[model samples]
Target: MAADRRVAEGLEHLKEAEKCMKTSFFKWKADYDGAASAYTKAGTCFKSAKSYDQARQAFLKAAECNVQNNVMFHAGKAYEQAGMMCKELNDLNRAAQLIEKAGHLYREHGVPDTAASTFDRVAKLLEPTNPQKAVDYYLIGSDITECEDRPRQAADFQKKAAKLLVRMGNYDRAVEVLKVEKKFQIEGENAPEVSRVTVELVLCHLARGDFVAADKAYKDAYGIPGFTESDHCRELAELLDAYDENDQDRLSSVAARPMFKFMDNDYAKLARGLQAPGGGEGGKKKKAALLDEGIEEGMEKGQLENQEVGGEDEDEFEGGLC
Candidate 1:
């Protein structure tokens, strides 16, 4: 109760502080960075005080000050934060403009991967403005670029674009990205898009509990085109099938080509179950096998000694986190 009352009092003080800052130099100061720093601190205080609008305004002020001070990165970050706030309020166009500004600044500073990712983010915000254009920008980052220049980063962007495209009824492009991701020769990207690129792969890793390998495979797959049946995708599919047999593994198997290969290992066994001639029923059996195996394993030790098995219920299964 005391804490809540104190918070209320602090919020009143924050409003006074906001009034002071607004009256004071929401005016240019000689040292823009210093002024921006003050505004950022003010924003933090306002945020703590539960004054979202004031915090948003302070962050915007800080961004403008950063631009004035020639600190593009900080400016970009500030706008990104403000854009997030605006997005939370469903003010999409303003959010998009702010995010676009950030992307433009990142591009001006020669940060292609960051710029590319920023563009991807901004495009998402502007989906209502033009959905195709967002997808086009994502494709530019993912495809139409070579391994010699930001290939891995571009591939990542492509993956993100492909996902959104899939939602947009661009399945052909989505499949094309998955099919081509394995051909790039580059290793890792210094910066990555915050969208679907890494997420698709992360979902794969979760199925197998192989995070290390997942990261490597995703990076390798990003920039390469001919690597459609890449080891990463096949292995991920196989892993997912291990838990739930209902999945499409043929494409991954075909894609994992000369470069990276997913052998006839554990995943392979599951893949066989998932890809057999019987199709859906085969998948169901595989899922049953996994569940039975889990139950047996639990009964093997004192693991389930303190627990009781529940009533018989209809078993269900599905696969492919990616």
Candidate 2:
């Protein structure tokens, strides 16, 4: 429980800071820098008191003041702090939106990597409830990463986005994203990565019930030297053949063959649904659950892991306090 005295103290500090900021901005010859600094102090006090919602508001006000003062870099940095507070409060959607704003501001300030990272966070936050939005943000982030000359990191984000798209059953878009990755991967250098992407593409096609497309993807994947020899690859081939033959029993057997340890093999569930008594409603529910869980994993993992990259930058934020 929050201490009542601490909460009241925090609110008092916040109100006093707001009063000072207004006095500075409106009556003191528009001293925007002073107002921004006061707001940053208010945010610091709120954060120290564990009043995260108030801290977020204070930080956002600081950002607005910085923007008005033409200190765009500080504005972006202030928004980044506000986003962190929202994230801490479990208001992920609000955090993502603020982070996206920070990303654009950072990009405008010529901080490519920071901008890319902020966009990545936004994508991860949106992945579960709005995968399409996640994919869009990931694309933007990956392009920025590429521009920052971090091709491998860019490829990783693209692959992540593609996987989310596949989980969302947007196979066509997944294929497109993977194709972009393919263009970046050097032959014999990232060959395994390329092969993995191809495997994912084949699975996406199969999930979409495009047997011919799946077969084509499988064949294309095999054309890469040493690609079709893995036991996993062999199982994928058999699965494709079964799907092409319209043999539900064979498809079910092949899809359940334990080749996919990383992803849920929904093909087996789909086949079983066809063979079920009540028109596959149970299978449909399972498939939907699988999609939800997969996307949720991506979203939650990003928040858990990705936040560690630049945490040491807190000292810079400390310097902004009045």
Best by lDDT: 2
Q: For candidate 2, write residues 236-262 as lDDT tens digits.
A: 777766655555556566656555544
Best by TM-score: 2
> For candidate 2, what is the lDDT?
0.74
Error of 1 at 50 (Å): 3.6
Query: Candidate 2: lDDT of 242?
Result: 61
TM-score for each predicted model, relative to the true structure: 0.45, 0.71
Question: Candidate 1 on 1-322: residue-level lDDT in tens?
Answer: 6545545654554455355345344554355666677677766665665566666787898898888778989999889878876876778777877887787787678666676777777777666676777776666555434423655766666655555654564444554564344334233432233222333443434334454554564555455453444545555445445334333444244324332234323323222333322343655565789999998887775444433332122122233333
What is the TM-score (0 to 1) of candidate 1? Answer: 0.45
Q: Where is model 2 more than 4 Å wrong at Cα?
A: 1-28, 87-91, 186-188, 223-225, 264-322
Error of 1 at 139 (Å): 3.4
